[model samples]
Target: MRRLLVPLVLVLSVGGSLGGCGWAGRHAETSKPDVFQLQGYVSVGGAASGVPGTPCLAPTSVPDVVAGATVRAADADGKVIAVSSLDSGVLAQASDGFRCNFAFRMKNLSGSRPSYQILVGDRPAQTFQTRELTEGKPAVVTVTASS
Candidate 1:
């Protein structure tokens, strides 16, 4: 009976000490920077050129300016964390006869899976994700108007 009691106490002590060490290590790892800035570009595009008198599709271009557009970032729980609006200049000249660029920036993000949405006036909202947005680089998100 005495020998069994001695070994049990020793095993418990060692287990407790190891568990505490793991907890400390996990806390240390979380001390690094976790927040980041999410920046990107949103462009609303559609068929610009067509046959003068018939139905002909032209090359893709950013001519359909999505005015009063607001971009938002939401978390896993659908909580909005950041937002930005498109500038008039960008909207006016967004299409360079090709793809136009509108800038958006959201700061203090957790660098996790974030949902992105472009809200345009009375149009079906263009929704997507931030998984493709590289760090330190502006991501390009193209939205098309529902016709």
Candidate 2:
């Protein structure tokens, strides 16, 4: 009985020591910077006179921009709201230092246009409305909300 107790205690001590080493090892690993980000971009596209319509607006300082491109978003009914474009410079002022704004632009694609409600994650940040788009020029839309 005495011998068994001695070995059991030694085994337990070694196990605990190994567990601590594993934890330290994990912390030593280099990882990406943790940050809050908003990113979106256009997928569909068109062209004119054998030339591509502005494939996408270059990202700038606008809240409605995404990776220097324009894209669109929609609701279930498919109502357009606002145009989004990439504006990385503007988002640099986000209250949350780690936050960003990236989205696809949206023009009045349907008969009825929807109102805009900017979001960050699931939280509503702002709201706005856009006028009807008469020119075929695509409208920009940005979504700085996390998916």
Candidate 3:
């Protein structure tokens, strides 16, 4: 009985250590994508230059100027995780320029490197990896609108 107990204890200890060390490296992969804050500036005609332009400028304008635009984040599986329009409280103006920031949650996302398609209004959609769209560093998307 003593001999059998020793081997069982050793096996359990090793297995516990291996499991604690993140076995199969699956611990790093999230079961479901996490909800992250995604904030960025959306300007018609061109991108925000981080410079306060003159009033009635060509590109920069008030927050309501882009109130009709929408921003969508689609996961790799083509699932729309978040959709934020420039209407209401989602739009704001900073010292630099007008911003259309939103809380973007992701779903159906896996793998070490997950990416999403960032669609901004009528402009071309931009692709960004999860690592590149972290907190504090917002993705800048520009679009051109017709008269």
The candidate with the higher TM-score, 2 or 3, is 3
lDDT of 1 by residue, 96-129 (tens): 3323345667777775566555443333454556
| TM-scores for every candidate against the unseen true structure | 0.47, 0.23, 0.45
- Model 3, residue 138: distance off in Å is 0.9
Q: Candidate order by lDDT, highest to lowest?
A: 3, 1, 2
Candidate 3, 70-144: lDDT as tens digits: 678777765676777653224345555554333233333332447767776545577777776663455665444
List runs of model 1 lying over 4 Å from the truth: 1-30, 46-68, 89-97, 114-134, 145-147
Q: Candidate 1, 2: how far from true, in Å?
A: 60
Residue 89 alpha-carbon offset, candidate 1, angstroms: 4.3
Tell me the tens digit of each residue's lDDT in model 2 across 58-91.
2233323345443334444444334455443222
TM-score of 2: 0.23
